[model samples]
Each structure stands twice: as C-alpha cells, then as structure tokens.
Target: MKKRINNHQRSTIKKVMNYIRRYWGYLGMSIVLAAVTVALTLYLPVLTGRAVDLILEKGVVDFAGILAILKKMAVIILLTAAAQWIMNACNNKITYNIIRDIRKEAFEKIERLPLKYIDGHSCGEIVSRVIADVDQFADGLLMGFTQFFTGIVTILGTLIFMLTISVKITVAVVVITPVSLLVASFIAKKTFSMFKLQSETRGEQTAFIEEMIGNQKVVQAFSHEDEALEKFDEINGRLQKCSLRAIFFSSITNPATRFVNSLVYAVVGVVGAFTAIAGGISVGQLSALLSYANQYTKPFNEISGVVTELQNALACAARVFELMEEPSEVPDAPDAVNLEEADGHVALEHVSFSYVPEQKLIEDFNLSVKPGQRVAIVGPTGCGKTTLINLLMRFYDTNSGTIRVSGVPVNDMTRKSLRNNYGMVLQETWLRSGTIRDNIVMGKPDATDEEVIAAAKASHAHSFIKRLPHGYDTVMAEDGGNLSQGQKQLLCITRVMLCLPPMLILDEATSSIDTRTEIKIQEAFAKMMKGRTSFIVAHRLSTIQEADIILVMKDGHIIEQGRHEELLAKKGFYANLYESQFVNTSSQA
Candidate 1:
C-alpha cells in the first residue's frame, strides 16, 4: 500500500511538471526574479554587520561610514522588494494559466467520452471533479508557486552567506534543519490518503445533492423526505470525519517544523557566542551570523508547510488526471467518410449490446427501415427502446454485428457526420439559457427569423411564444424553467421542425403536451415526416394509429408487427396492449 501511494505521488508530480512546462517562459522569469531577490536581500546582513562595526569603534564614531552603509542598505532593500513584486506577478500568471488549461482539457475529454461512461457515473461526480476538485487544486498550487521558489532561494542564499561568515555555525544550522524536514515529511506522507478520501467523499456527496435537487419533486411525490435527509446526514457526517482527519494530520506540520527551527536558531546563537568570545569572529560578524541563522531556518518552516499543502494538491490533481486519462470514445475510423444527404435506408444486422455483460439488454436485434418509411415502436419500459436510439445515433457502438445507414456501415462514418443526418426529440426536453429563437436554431444555426417562426407555428409553439413579453426574442430561464412543460416540449419539437433532417427519431416526443396540442403537433409531424424516414417510439397507441407500420416490442425483439387495424384483427400481443390502454382510459374518464 505504501509503495502504491508513493508511486501515485511521483506520477502526480511528473504530470504536474509537464503542465507547468508549457509555460516555461513565465516560470523561468519567476525563478530568475526570485534568485535576484534572494541574492540582493542576502547582503542586508552584511550591511548591518558593517554598520554595527562602524558605530562600535573604540575611537571617535565614524558617522560617515555608518551613513554610507545605511544608504547601501536602503538601495538593496528597494531592489529586493521590486524583484519580489515582479516574481509574485509571474507566479500568479503561471498558476492561473495552468489552471485554465487543466479545466479546458478535462472538459474536452468529457465531451469525447462514450455514453456508456457517462451512464455509469453520476453527473454530480463529474461536476465535482471539474469544479470543486479543481478549485482545491488551484489553492494548493498557487500557494506553492508563491512560497516554494522563494523559500528554496532563501535557504540556499542564507546558507552561503553564513558560510562566508562562519562555517562552524553553518554546519550546526544545516544538521539541525533535517530534523524539521523529517518531521514534516512524515506528517505530509500521512495526509495524502486522508485528503484523497476527503475528495472522493466530497464528490459522492455532491452527486447525492445534485440527484436530490434534480428530483425533489419526485421525492416529495413519493413522501421520501425523511429517507433522503437520513441518507444526506450519513454522507455529510462521513465528509466531516474525513475533513477532520486530514486537517489534523497536516495541521501539526507547522509547530513541529517551528520547534526544529527554534533548535537550529539556539545552536547557532550559542556556537556563535563561543566563537566570538574566543576572538574567532568580531561582534558585528557574530550578529550577522545570528541573522543568517534565523533566515536559513525560517524557510524550513514555510517549505514544510508548503509541502503539506502540496500533498493536498497532488491528491486533487490525481483525480483530475484520472478523468483526463479515461479512454476517449473510439476515434473516427482512418478511412471514415462523411455521411451526406442520406437516403435514410437504415438496417440493423444482428446487432447485440448491453449496459453490462451480466445483464444483456439487446441481443441479436435486427431491423430494416426503408427510405421514407414511417415505423412506430411501442414497448414496455426497460425493454431497450432507447438503447436502439443510442445505437442508431452511434452514441454507443454495437458489441457485435453492424448498423448501417444508406447501405454504409455507421462505424465507417464520422460520428458527427452520421448524427447530422438525423433529427431527434426525446421524452426529456433540454434548452439552454438563451432566447427562444436561439434554441429553435440549435440544429440549424443559420436559420432565418421567418423560417424559425414558420417552424414554431408548425410545431404549435408560435401562439404561446408570441404571448411572451418579447415574443421569440425573450430569454429562457435555465432548462426553460420559466416555461410550462407543454411549452418546453413545443420548443423542442420546433428544433426538429427547423432542421427537418432526412431522417427523424421521436421518442415520446409529445408526452408532456396537452392531448389537444398533441393532436395538432402530430398533424404537423405527419406533414414534416411525409418524405423523411421516421422512427417514432411512443406508448400512446392512438397517436401511432396512422403509422405505416407499428412494431410491438417485448424483451428487445419485435414480437408482432402490422398496421393498427391488422394487429387488432389478429388479436395478438399488440391487440391485448391496445385493448388494455383503451379500457383504462375509458374507465378513468
């Protein structure tokens, strides 16, 4: 376990260095400034020593010499302060730039991931990595950038200046410093795993919060308030424990390092006093040695603290890197062609797939959809209806066999190009925080105002949209929260109407709309799908009564198929389903 953790820390450090390497120019400038700052600042002790010697002369006091030394001290102080300021500016720039690049790469990797990966993980977990974890990492990295470089230069500069004054004292200081380092290193090693657990638990907690927030209505509908609160308390208590444990381990580093620093200071003072008494060095020289001793040891305290914080940085960075390194969706085939203006002849040849190996969902699924064909698929929930849409859109590749569009294998076409050939509206509605016109033009960004209004009218969305304060120009709240469910569905349908791709997939497209509005939208959809190959997945048998072919699916296969009248005449599984739904509706009325 220890070996694995050490390796992980080493790997995180290596990857972090690679990211910083991209800004070598800024980093190099920061280092040079830090060196200059330290070098000039190191000479201050020497100036103080000279001033002390001049003022303590047995003869008449040489005010002239003291004044000159003071002037030099002022000049060096100004230069050192100036260099330190510029160095901090450079550090800030480098830290923020690296942070931006990391977030950009993480988000881009997420976009390139397969649907299976997203389906297998919680949205809150991914969001936490991108947001909370990145923020935590940024704090640690910025702290390092500001302190680590200057701390190293200070220690080295102070050591060299002290060596020039007295090696005997320098050796004592150096030897005692390792004790502090040993203490800090030991504590730092223990914090990494604790902090890692804290980060993971925080992500899980975020996932739960997001899940509950998104489904609060459902939770209330089911009277699950107490259960949710209990679950949340459990997660919150775990996070509190993790946080306390990590903080406890890291918090002791400062005092431990300070104690060692104080020991080093005491040794330097006692040794320098003895040396001065023996006439090995003058009083002024001894003063400079004491100052050097303080300077040299102070950084050990700071650097050790930085190291503790650095452990936290590495823990957060490992999570971010893990996300970036997830295998991206299979790259486009080397010879993949663009699917342009497809004739919409889709065929599935023995396609097999499952969300998990142990529980296969769709196996040996076969279908043939002709150009301009209107096929309606109806099935019980959890029967792999949406899974078929996922394959058709190439959101997930088939486990075996093939799915082809226009006689061309889907795998042989660039995913973007393949997806462009179809327009889809699912049961769920998604709208960005944008104006009504903006959402309508998502699939076809260059659509004109007149065309957008025409599509809205056809989708039965125009009348309500016009009633809004700004008509089509009105901005929507997040996810169109400002709109009614029926209104949101109407807007989504407007998107498909505006694009009118050669092929269409409507999965419970009008489920949220009023029955009266649904009838009008169905009329509009009928006109839109007139010459386009269309696949409608619906539970409303009445809506699909006019479909050219109605497929009854059970357990991932089409058990029965025919026109509505033909299926009813046969009195098979489809007939029984239709009869039951009709009976339920009549009884409810």
Candidate 2:
C-alpha cells in the first residue's frame, strides 16, 4: 500500500511539473533573481567582517573607509530585497496560472465523465477535489517556489563560504546538519499518512453536510433531526481526531529540527573561538564563519517547516488526481452517422441491461413503435420502467442487442444527434437558478419570448407564472426552491413544449400536479401527441386509457401488451393493475 501511494504521489508531482514547464519564462526569471539575492545576502556578512578586521589592524577607526564599506553593504541589501520581491511576484503568477489551467481541465473532465461515475460519487466529494484540493495545491507550489528554491541556494552558498574560511568547522556543520534532515524525514514519514486520512475525513464530512442540506425538507418531514445531528457529530468527531493527529506531528518537526540546528551553531561558535585564539584563524574570519554557520542552518529549519505543509498539499493533490484519473465515457465510433430528421420510429430488439453485473434489471426487452404512435408503459416499482427510458435515451447503453431510432442503431448514430430528436420530462423536475424565461428556453436557446410564453400557456404554467413578482422574468432560487413542486413540474413541461422534438418521453411528468391541472395538461398533451412518437411511463392507469398501446412489465419482462381496452378485456396483469388502482381511487373518495 505504501509503495502504491508513493507511486501515485510521484505521478501527481510529474503532472504538476508539466504545468510548470508551460511558464518556464517566469520560473527561469525567478530562479535567476533568487540566485542573485542569495549571493548578495551571503556577501553582506563578508563585508561586515572585513570592516571589523580593518579597525582591529589599525587599532584606530578609519571612519571614511568604514562608512564607505557600510554604505556599499546597505546598497547590496536593498538590491537583494528588491530582487526577492520580484521573485515572489513571478512565483505567484506561475502558481495561479497553473492553478487556473488545472481547474479548467478538472471541470472539463467532469463534463466528459460518464453518468456511472457521477452516480457513484457524492457531489461534495467531487466539489472538494475541484475547489479545496486545487486551492491547497496552488498554495503549496507558491511556498515551494518562494522558500524552497532560495532555502536550498542559501544553504549551499553559505556552506561554500564557510569552507573557504575553515574546512574543519565546515565539516562539523555538514555532519550535524544530517541530524535535522533525519528528524524531518522521520516526522514526515510518520505524519504523511495522517494528513492523507485527514483529507479523506474532511471530504466525508463535506459530503454529509451537502446531503443533509439538500434533503433538509425530507429530514424535517420525517422528524429525523436528532438522527441527522447524531450522524453529523460522528463524522465531525472523526475529522477532528484525524486533524489533531496531523497537526500534532507537523508541529513537532520545526522545533525538533531547530533544536538540532542550535547545537550545530554552538559547536561552530566554540570551535571558531578556539581557532581564532590559537592564531589559526583571524578574529574577522571567525566572525564571518559564525555568520555563515547560522545562515547554513537556517535553511534546514525553514525547509523542515515547509515539509509539513507540502505533505498535506500532496495529500490534497492525490485526491484531485484520483478524480481526474477516472475512466471517461467511451468515445463514439469513427463511422457514427448523424440522426437527422428522425421519423419517430423506435425499436428495441432483444435488449438486455443491468446496473450491476450480478443483478439484471432489464432482459430480453423487445418493443416496436411505428411513427406517430402513443405508447404507455406501466409496471410495479423496480420493474425497470425508468431503466428502459435510460436505455432509450442512450444514457446507459444496453448490455446486449440493439436500440434503434428510425431503423438506425443508436450506437451507430452520434449520441448528441440521436438525443436531439427526443424531448423528455421526468418526474423529478430540474430547474437552475435563473429567470423563468431562461429555464423555459433552455431546450431552445434562441426561442423568442412570444414562443416561450406560448409554450408556458400550453402547459398551463403561464397563469401562475404571470402572478409571480416579475411574471415570466421572475428569477428562481436554486432548484426552483421558490416554486411549488407542481409549478416546477409545469416549467419542466414547458421546457419540453418549447423544444417540440419529433419524439417525447414522459416519466410521471404530471405526478406533482393536482387532478384539475393534470386534466388540463392532459388535454394539451393529447393534441401535442397527435403527430409525434410518445412513450409515457405512468403509475395512474387512467392516464393511459387513450394510449394506442400499453405495455405491462414485471421482473424486467413485458408480460402483457395491447391497447388499454384490449388488455382489460384479456383479464390478465394489465387488467389486475387497472382494477387495483380503480378500487384504491374509490376508497380514497
């Protein structure tokens, strides 16, 4: 497992490097400026030591010479600061640009991903990958470029200067430095898994919150508030524990490395004093060597701190990469043809399908509808009615056999072109946060206002819409929260009415509306269905009495089929279903 994790981390790092390569100009400039800054910083101590030596040699202050050297050092320090500022600016540009591209690609990946992937993952988890994880990755890269680059340069440059002063002291510093490295490595190894766990728990918590908020009405309706709170607390407690472990380990790395660095500094100071007194090295050289020793150890402390952050960032990156790596939907065949001007003829030949391999939901499903025919399908729950619609729309391809529109196999036609011929309104209405007019025109983007209002009126939606605050221009809340369920359903139907495709599939589309409103909508539907191929999945048997053909399904097979009157006359499955519904309606009345 550890090896596999390391491989994933390495792959993510390589991908990040490829993004960096695109902005090589900015990176190259930042590197050059960082090097210049480090050089100037190291030279400042040398200049100070030289000034001290001049005063010691003469045993009298050379004020003019001292003043000139001090001035030069100040100028160099200012230039170093300026270069550091420019380097940081460049680093920010590179970091954010790469982050933008990463986010763009991740979103595009979501667009191309199959419905299967979306169905299996929680919305909050995917959202975390795109937003939170990407943000963390960007921040880490910014710190790495700004601090990591300069820290390494400072360490190497200071070591070189120390070596020129005295090889013995430099060797001691090098030997002691490894202790800090070992401590950082040990802490990082212990804490990396903790950070990864924390990230996972955080995503879980986020997902739970999103689910709860989305279904808050359901929870309240069922008086499940206490249960919801308990579940949230459990998830929150797990996240807190994971976070504490990660923070505890990360916090120890810096101070532990700093303690070892202090020991190195003490050794350097003591050894330099002895050498200076023994006439092995000058006082001025000793001063410079001491400064270099401090500079050399500083990077170790800074790097140790950054290692903790980088580990957490890598954990976030791993999650984002996991999302990006999911298998996308299969591409269309090379010779796929366009489904132009469909004649509304649909057929399913020996079609078989399953959401999972072990549990088949549709099997040997065969159906044929001539042009301009109205068909209604009725079945018990879990009898594959909706699954049939899914297969027809090519949202999920059949496991075997063929579904064809106008005698052309669905797989042989481009999915976009094939779907364009059908307009669908589902039981669960979906509306975005937009004006009423915008939602209605979604299916027909270039639709005129007059056409949109006309469609709304036909669906019996225009009257209520006009009573809203802004009429057709009224803006809806997310998922049409401001509208009643029935109103939302009407808008969905209005959207389909605007599209006016050659074929229609209505899956309990009028389930939310009252009987009176439903009757009105049904009257409109009757006229609309005249010249179109329509498939209705209805639970209320009365709605389909006028349908040209009715299919009664059970256990993934069509057990009965005929006109509603014919099926009733057969006294079989369809007759039993109709009688049950009729008796239930009578009881309710």
Q: Which candidate is the best by TM-score?
A: 1
Instruction: Quote each prediction's TM-score.
Output: 0.98, 0.97
lDDT score, candidate 1: 0.91
Question: Taking the candidates one at a time, how many backbone clashes does each contain?
Answer: 0, 0
lDDT of each: 0.91, 0.91
Clashing pairs in 1: none
Compose the digit string of candidate 1's lDDT tens values, residues 357-460: 89888888889989999999998888888888899999999999999999999999999998899999999999999999999999999999999999999998
Off by over 4 Å in 2: 57-59
The sequence of per-residue lDDT tens digits that candidate 2 reaches over residues 187-217 is: 8777778888988888888888889999999
Cα-based lDDT at residue 300, candidate 2 = 83
- Cα lDDT of candidate 2 equals 0.91
